[model samples]
Target: MVIKVERVLHMVGGGGETSYATNSRLQEKAIYRTKPILEIAVAEMYRTLLPEKMVVVDLGCSSGPNTFLVVSEVLGIVGDLCRRLEQKPPEIQFFLNDLPGNDFNNVFRSLERYEKKMEEENGGLLVPHYVVGVPGSFYGRLFPCNTVHFFHSSYCLTWLSQVPQGLGSEQGVPLNKGNFCIAENSPPQVVKAYQEQHRRDFSTFLKSRYVELSIGGGMVSTFLGIKSKHPANDELNYLYGLVAEALNAMVSQGIISENKVGTFNLPIYGASMQEVKSVIGVEGSFDVEKAESIWDPFDDSDNVLSGKNVASTLQAVMEPLISHHFGDAILHELFSLLADIITARHLLKDKCNYTVLNSNSLSSCHRRHGH
Candidate 1:
């Protein structure tokens, strides 16, 4: 009885203006964190490759809002760097990428809006070469070999389309035969499996980047990560399992069905800094110009004190998990009740206090020569 979870579609643009507000806030945070890193990355790419014209690609570009922010920032930095180096600024061809199911219509609209702004401000001569939409995973190759000068992906790599099979409610077991699970109190085997999967996924990701980027090119990535040496008992994974347990309890109470509960899974993994570096370094392509762990204050806060906020935040974070485990048939009333119960009795209230870490505090090591 292998119950496979369904892919959860994140509600991006559905209702009126309000529906897009949450996504907009999230996008803003993503842009803010990624902007400086991208500036450094593009400047490094130009310095190292010294190409006459550089082509930049934004992998997992999602909507044009965030993509444009990164692209514009990178161009500004590259322009400044070119002036310092006494060279012509590289012509940038922006590639906005995302999964095929993403809201590209909105993305294209956003691009048009930014394009107009650029033309109006720069007298149309400073306009970037814009190719509106390119769809695919960043973990796979989507462009010509060695065509991209700089690549950037932020808050995107943690997601895979689906949780690996033989885990969660569908599998009915904590430990798969060969896979690792990172749930709270997860067995040693389970944790090992999860780490192994991350290693594999990251290796593939690096190999793909190696193919996509030319020699001496670099990438700047920022993702949700954990701080754990041992594979078992990771706090973040435990948090997810706790949320999953609450959802399952709702299913048992007839508030949702087993089939519905098994419809979605959390589409993310919080890898530790060491784990990310290990995988990327082993690939031997990227120089790892910068690698650092920074906390997202917005995400770390304990805003779930109020019932309404709890329910809303729970719905935002756990909706994918719920939709992955349970079908979309769960009633709103049941979801609210489950959220209330979890907040009242089970949520980690004390550990909710979060502080933002300095970006310079990141542990950065360059790639060794020849890999």
Candidate 2:
């Protein structure tokens, strides 16, 4: 099995135009869209029990402004809710997790200012939560048993730990063919290979969390996904189609070789609601409480930023992966085309065909039943 794990696919680790920090407004919007769920989780936890000490884990917490956004929200919620109930807020131990290649420096640097901001906003009434960075893959155990109480992640699960295996020929050659992700024209075998990898990774994710979450603890996660099960329903198919077409046009102009497209496969799969439900149902550790596709990840409601928001957002995280595969030479050309495509689509219609998912932001929380 051949699998490629390019470092860039992890995330853009800075505040540049193509960096995760600059382009994560979509994720923020997604987070806000899921506010009702967060409120329920916070309310439930504090209502039933408020431990003197508690733990919260943020997985796939990349180096960006959004890095601590959810953590801050969780802290704020815990503090406010406890105060309302006349209970002391739990002493929080916050853990930020990501692959080893992620930029922890940028994250650490922002901590002091973020803390100051939190302190100022809460009128010095905020609980001081301890934060630690844990670097590793969440597809496996990331902490000691019974350590975390509440877990959160967003905009990261679509990434497989490695490229899907078995997309090669008997001769050990790549069969995905000139595409970096699922396409409308992609072969069934290619699609199957990607789907299998998502199911395996998602199941591993659930089992690992089951081990780490405390009794009655839960998780909140989000992914960029859709509700349709058909492989063609993938939004990446459309977005990357814009990219693949541009690359092909360049191929005809002889800017690059035709063979480049044959080996590149986007190591991403936004799980459909059906796909996620199947795994959660099978894993049996976490119950899928709400698998609703709330809002479009690309809801440019009033054409404000128009489509630049979409392009910049995708560019920040994708530049590394796309440039890694195609070299940085053609990126400017590639995304410019993508921006135009997004703008035209946004202006012409109020609703998008593909639902932008950032689910549980994977916000699925499983109560520890039968534990």
Q: Name the best candidate (by lDDT).
A: 2
Model 1 spans > 4 angstroms off:
1-11, 14-21, 24-27, 82-87, 117-127, 168-181, 230-235, 258-267, 299-325, 334-348, 351-371
lDDT of 2 by residue, 109-196 (tens): 9999988888898788477689899988898999999778788877678889788876665365546555667877667888898899
Over all chains combined, what TM-score does candidate 1 have? 0.77
* Residue ranges of candidate 2 with Cα displaced over 4 Å: 1-3, 169-174, 234-236, 297-305, 344-371
At residue 298, candidate 2 shows an lDDT of 62
* TM-score of candidate 2 relative to the true fold: 0.89
For all candidates in order, the CA lDDT equals 0.57, 0.74
